[model samples]
Target: MSDTGTPRMKRPSLHEEIVAEVRRMIVDGELAPGEWIAEMQLCGDLGISRTPLREALKVLASEELVLLEQNRGTRVAPITFDAMLAQFEFMEALQMFAGRLAAERASEDELERLNAMHREMIRLHETGDRSAYFSLNQEVHTLIASAARNPPLFSVHEASAGKIRRARYQANLSYDRWAESLQEHGEFVAALTARDGQRAGELLSDHLRRTGIAVCSALKAFEDAGERAPDDRKGRAR
Candidate 1:
């Protein structure tokens, strides 16, 4: 996190604000992966006590953003590139099934909901809002999961979303890519409308796997630019 903390008015509980800022720091690469976040120093810098800081740390720890060893204190958990690749694989299978289920069960209302989200996502593309676009990208996936009406599928998708959001935001920076993703969603919608389960499944799985490749490419570019991730880059998502 920045030495000066969030750098805004801090009238809230202080803990929440600090946690949000620190989380953003990790998400935006300000706090490098695997770096230890010293509670004492952070408390001193933010002019807060240990109570709030520890609470904030526990929250992050639960989210797997950081690891708390028995007595070694907290360090940012390494983002395993392989684990991320594995997530993409799981996402492929999960979303394919979701697509098939959606094809079978989607009502007019459900299709309209997905379509409305796609329209808003398109608007985000025009405005060049990468973050917003990724958020909607997440919503669309989760909506499909929910529409599948399978609690287990919904749980698994929700669990993976935090990691997926990071990868998506890191990769889909260009406006052209956002437009392309919108078009992909359009294809998904078309399949759903046509009641084509197998085709929809293929499209959904391909969409996720391709997006994983995009993010992996971006990660490789970062490493080539003379930076290091706390994660391994040992394989191709292709």
Candidate 2:
């Protein structure tokens, strides 16, 4: 221990690091959906052993990010427009509920935090930092959910958020759509600031619905361009 330290913080385990890396790869499309997850390749790239990599795969499997099979080993989970819409349906409901509850119950401090997160997101958007803006956009939603002060609701919201995260990431790839989304977010914040629970809920529902539409549009654009995701491969077990 250092002289002034009470205790040294433990570092993330190798398995945890592997899991985080794999998750990022999947979300960033480095490991595209329905692609074979080559354990050996990943182990080499990440400079880790098969043991930890397998362990990390187990964690991702539990999160529905990857699929494990007895004969097929593992593959990135298949993504479909229908599936994306389904996940967004649940996310919309959950987030709308969260916005309503937050508007009604949020403490002054929580409201301030939400405002600060929105400001940061706007700043990143203006600078054309899409990745950073998206990151903070997620945080703003999470903080809004937590501000509801309902533990059970927050738990459910977090699970749904995880499932739809990748599709949501793809949704903002178009510049015009991204700008429109920022405007929607601004309206949401304004509703919350006014403590208008009904308006906030309505705004949140519309925002998430629009996001799903944008994601679908992006998927169609990719299809039209003949850019196929790994999931399109036929005769392969998903």
Candidate 3:
């Protein structure tokens, strides 16, 4: 309660802000996966001391976004194909359930809000604002999950979604995939509008499956190129 007797919004503490910033850095690939975290450099960049930075890192470690190795120091967790596949599979199941529930439970106002968000996402996409589009893209998924009216399902979805956000973002880097994703969302919205739970669920799941394939393909290509680079260098020397 505030002094005026109205409930006051509690602001996030510095510790919480640090955690979120670090998490964003990792998710946005500013802190690359498998790259060792330079604690001192980060502390200097963020203008914070080691104590709070370490505390923030511990929280990220718990989220499995960072690895804490004894003596080896902390590094951003690597995004492996196996892990990406598993995460997408898990998310596909969750989204399918949520899509069904959302079609059944979402109110008119909520559905309208989702439509509005979809419009904004389209605008962002057309303008080539990828970062903003990606953020709104996640928001669209979040809104659908929220509309499901199932707390336990939403909670689990959110926790898992955080882990795979980077993969989802990276999957959109392909122009074809990005455009296809928009078309999928359009169909998804139409299904929701018609209150067709089955169609909505299937569409959402298929969308995720495609996204998983794109991410896995991209990761494989990247790893293959990295491996070939050394051989190419040796050949040039010979």
Candidate 4:
């Protein structure tokens, strides 16, 4: 702890806690997409007051994780084909930019760190642990972005990440798609290791485009099957 001799903060604010919990619930399917969030029910489950919960919901809404209807309550945002495609277009461009920068600028130490992360991801993928694999995959990509040392690019990438995380999660639901993702990631790491910026950028862009197609196909199937439930809980919270 001698780097600065300062104590690290370990506690999160009430709003932060609530926000994280709610986001997890949404992303993990504890709260389904398009599901209406009953205010009293959720507050009771979390044992929190309305003030902090409302603040948290407001934050999530801004991130597009939740929809706040005027004179109505909050609901988890529904996933749609068009919305997923739109987000992926932006994400793909940013990822390509980051990949090029990372290949050009990542230090040996940084490459070692990313290689370690890539190994873990490979292990998870081989074991068919989709959830854990996806989580690590996100970290690997984030590390690449960080290694790029482009603050503005990282800022935009981080913001887009929150909105598209759920879509990315859903993209790998198909076994074939998941396997393809693992293969793509392997090549991506290889490109990074070789310091091939152009190759890395191309791989990253292709990876994102495939993910977008997967998500759109899945959403279309859901729509065709009429499996999506209508949100009926739409009134103002008491």
> Evaluated with lDDT, which candidate comes out highest?
3
**Candidate that beats the other on TM-score, 1 or 4, i.e. the better one:** 4
Off by over 4 Å in 3: 2-6, 169-172, 227-238
Sort the candidates on TM-score, descending order. Answer: 3, 4, 2, 1
Please give, for residues 31-127, the per-residue lDDT of candidate 1 as tens digits.
5567887889878977888888888889878877778888788887665556678878888888899999988888889888888988887787777
Output the better candidate (1/3) by TM-score: 3
Candidate 3's TM-score = 0.86
What TM-score goes with each of the models? 0.71, 0.80, 0.86, 0.84
Question: Candidate 3: worst 10 consecutive residues by lDDT?
Answer: 229-238
Residue range with the least summed lDDT across 10 consecutive positions in model 1: 229-238
Query: 1-238, model 2: which lDDT tens digit per residue?
Result: 8689778889998777788889888865678777898999889999988988999999899988899988989998866777777888887888788889999999998888878888887788777776677667778888889988899999888766765666654443457777788889889888998999989998998988887777766666666776753322111100
lDDT of 3: 0.81
**lDDT, residue 87, model 2:** 82
Colliding pairs, model 3: none
52, model 2: CA deviation in Å? 3.5
Better of 1 and 4 by lDDT: 4
Q: Distance (Å) between predicted and true CA of 17, model 1?
A: 14
Candidate 3 per-residue lDDT, tens place, 1-238, comes to: 9889999999999999999999989876678778899999999999999999999999999989999999889999887778888998988888899999999999999899889988987897788776677777778888899999999999888778777776554443466777888889989988988899999999998888887777777666766676311111111100
State the displacement of the C-alpha of residue 122, model 4, in Å, after optimal TM-score superposition.
Answer: 2.4
lDDT-based ranking: 3, 4, 2, 1
Residue lDDT tens for model 4, 212-236: 7777776677678876633222110
